[model samples]
Target: MLKMMTFFQGLPGQQSLLGTLDPGLSEAESEASMSEASSEDLIPPLEAGVTPDGEQEGTSKKKKSKGLANMLSVFIKGKKKKDQPRSSETEVKSKARPELEGPPPTVEELKAALERGRLEAARPVLALERELEAAAAAGGTSDEELVRLQSKVEALYVLLRDQVLGVLRRPLDAAPERLRQALAVVAEQELEDRRAAAGTRAAALVDTLWRGGVEEVAAERLGARPAGVPAGLSEAESRFLHMGRTMKADLEAVVERLKPLFPAEFNVVHTYAQSYHQLFAAHLDTLAQFELCERDTYLLLLWVQNLYPNDILNSPKLAQELQGIRLGSLLPPKQIKLLEATFLSNEVANVKLLMNRALELESQRWAQDVAPQRLNGYCHCELAIDIIQIISQGQTKAENITSDMGMQIKQLLLVELASMLRSYQHIFDEFLEKSKLLKNYRANIIANINNCLSFRTSMEQQWQIPQDSPSHLMDPLKELKAHGFDTLLQSLFLDLKLLFKKFTQTRWAAPVETLEEIIATVGSRLPEFSELQNCFREELMEAVHLHLVKEYIIRLCKRRLVLKTAEQQQQLAKHIEANAEAIQSFCTQNGSTATWLHPALPTLAEIIRLQDPSAIKIEVATYATWYPDFSKGHVNAILAIKGNLSNSDVKSIRNILDINTGVQEASRSLFSLIKVV
Candidate 1:
């Protein structure tokens, strides 16, 4: 029965009083008693001089007996009746705990220590925690409890963490200035990473999804909407239906973020500020064309149309839409605002600033390369037109916001157009110069076909000479004029054709009246002056002029003129109509209803008249008309050659260039113009 008391050390003061053991009790009985007693029992101690037979002890032994008696009594009681001393005498004899000191580690450090078997590092913390747990477990006095009140401490720690996370995410709700500072750091980080981070798919998706931060999140944020309202979902209900862990915020954002998300699909960032960079760099040979509405790039107006065929079919409506648009109606404020806010806000201040900047740059670019960057042919012109199309599309919906901006862009486009005109000017000067320097030894035979630049002139002479007689002047003139004039005309036609293809887009040609007027004016007047025919001083001048006007006027001029005699006019009209009918069989004028002007009309006419092929022999050197290049060299050499002439010498080697070429062949006013290296 006495041994039953030992196990109840759960009570206060229990372990100290239960130290003395009962010698008389058998080991089995003692252990069974210890095991049967609840862990919460208080055990009684044996008195120092007390016998197993319960004898009372002497005075000297009495003190020790009192200690033993106290221990024995404590061991006999269950833990429920136990009392621990305020300060244990054993604790007074125990050595004090060694001080622990180090740079404090976080919770993660303790976990790491537990994994690594670092009990020494953990002991200091474990001791402090154990002391606090023990004070609560022990029913300790007010002094012990006040020393470590953990419940209050844990509550404070939780409150602090919640407040911090809320402040970081919705910082404006707490402090606007912090958000601004954070945004500055974020922008700098993005710029630095813009190029280097292209291949990282994760970052690109982040950029796409996060275009609108708080504003979009707030707009999309679910609240406790009334359950029956259409499309309005309550926050808790949405959570319930979303299943698993996913929420509703991500689903609704799909459509609004297409463009922003597109780059991420490839995990690449294009450095271009605008789509125009695609023109030069995109693989055009393999390009799968999507023909979009020329006037509506912002909308879903694309179809599969190549540059030629579909263009030929719907060209009329396309031209009308492009040309007929009111400059003001092109751009609406809402679209301007949307594009700016959605795409252009970072780089452009507003549409006005954008247009102004473009104008300043375009003018600068034009002045630098106007001469070198000639609108060489249809290809060159199409590229320029494409750039215009992009500009037009962007500004089409930019009406009110684009006003001042549009004006600026218009000025730039005009300047670029002017640059193209200057390029044509250089080409034309090279043409006319060669025509001037051609010696009369070149038979100045005029072709009836002013239209076919490839045509040769035939000369018919009425000479009162015997069959054996030779006319030297007639022979040389006929030979030279037929070959030389044909070459010069071809070179001139090439230059004019280039300009025609470049400046005269179908968009501007619809009125027909304006194009006709342009032809008349360009044929008659030299640039920098209003005079109709003063710049030229040669037969070549008449040929160049006729060639320019004939494209527009051939059908008009080939018919009978009111100034000619009735019989002569009637004959001319008959031949002209027949030639025109033949012309329609091969070539097509680029207009609606698609007219074809014939390819062989002029050739057939020449062959009809020149019955003898031996009359003129065409040489390999004559194929290029070498007229343009030769003219440039001849003029530059002439001003320097200074009458020192010989047959084999360059000065006397009648270059074909002098035939259609001119002096001072420059596209500009010979002033300052900067160029990009």
Candidate 2:
């Protein structure tokens, strides 16, 4: 029974015993009965033919055990047969279970899982690195986690390195479009993160490099170079070159380390190089704030502009970073061209400082001299030309510089020339003031004016200043011409006014000789007048003509000769006619003042011919109507000239002239006459 129970429990199908043993008993009761029966029937069954007896009990027990063993073997054999079917059923379930399983992992899912792991591991390091950068930038000490994160990042990189490289090397062309895009995006993001880390490290290293007076250290290193090397590198230039090289090497190392981790299209080298350039540029900007000589500043700027690799400007990424830089301010475009030309020609010795020093000394010499000599335009031109010549000397060897660049240099020199012209303006003003007292005032003014004008002309001719030269450069010369020549001409006109006044007072009727003398003085200096000759001639002629007419009118009023005979009256008439003709001829030859002057002449002659008081009154009234500008004093003078007329008669004539026209008519007319004069 025990053997049967153990065999039944061990069989794959054991629950059948409960059904086989119970017909009316409860299931739990049947199971309990069956279990008890199996336990109590532990003794082996007696042999098939043996009887139970005390003496034979032991032998019977052995025989019963043998027969039970045989029955147990048969039951065991039946249980093995039943277990075979269960094993086959288990095999069927095992085979079907695989078909019920989910699908295989997709490429996107794999990439997502990969990125998750990378970001999970890298997030803490990225956060700690950002904190470290902020601390460094703020001049604070780093947190302890920074060191730990550094190692963690290194370890993470090692772990993800193969995966990252595999993604980078994956053949996207062979992959499905969506999967390829997913992989590419993941790879690019990873590369970007790696580049960011490298940049942060490089920036920290640059900060360390900049400390301890970078310029001083570079100068020491440069001095240690062989004696055969060119000497005299500026502090800023030496430091810039040294720092650039150091930053380049450091960035290159960072790139080399990261190169295998990114795709070929990532251009890691360009990324690091751009960062290096930006770092170097910032360092240069910091150095720029220090006090430096012009030459040293120029050399530093040149090193930034030309000595560095063209890649700095050519790379789109780096170019974007440098867009805000004003390279022209440090070294002007023309100066840059000149320096580049000098370098390309292998004539590395810069004499610009020496040339500027010489120019400054030469400019100072002008201040030491007296008035006119100090204002020497020729000296100004020569100094300017010397500067231009020095610039041009470099241009001769400048195969790299463009013609437009050469023109730009000349234009810049012209601007310098304009600035220097300001110092001489006061000298010209002084000369113009003192010139009023000179006997040869016109000649002195002409010489000075010609000196400046000719100098400008020659400069334009020599330098080939186009008509469209930049207005800033030409404005100075225009101002000089406008102010200096105009002031001088005004002074000459003032002198002419005095001379004409004297001529009117002393030789009123016979004034052609004095007028000729004035015209001859101006005409003799015509060559000096250059562009201003026409204006000077027109103004002088007008002045002389008006003065001559005014003097003739005054002389006619002042004459007090009574006509005692017909011959005297005839002579007076002829003299008046001749004066009128001379004025008319002069007016016709010069300008248009003769319209009123020619009419006045005949009226005055008509008055002289009329001898009777009543006839003279009628003649004077007619003349007054014809020439309304004739005043009461002019009528009185005419009447006084007739020696027969009394003061009362002169007064009566004035009253008649006034009543016939209007009250104060003669006074109003006199104002108009004065305006004409």
By TM-score, the best candidate is: 2
lDDT of each candidate versus the true structure: 0.30, 0.44
Candidate 1 whole-model C-alpha lDDT, 0 to 1:
0.30
Off-target runs (Cα >4 Å) in candidate 2 are 1-235, 238-271, 278-423, 430-508, 511-514, 528-677
- Per-candidate TM equals 0.19, 0.31
The TM-score between candidate 2 and the true structure equals 0.31
Candidate 1 Cα misplacement greater than 4 A, ranges = 1-156, 159-411, 435-677
User: In model 2, what is the error at residue 445, expressed in angstroms?
Assistant: 6.8
Could you give me the TM-score of model 1 versus the true structure?
Answer: 0.19
Q: How many residue pairs clash in each candidate?
A: 56, 0
Q: At residue 340, what lDDT does model 1 achieve?
A: 37
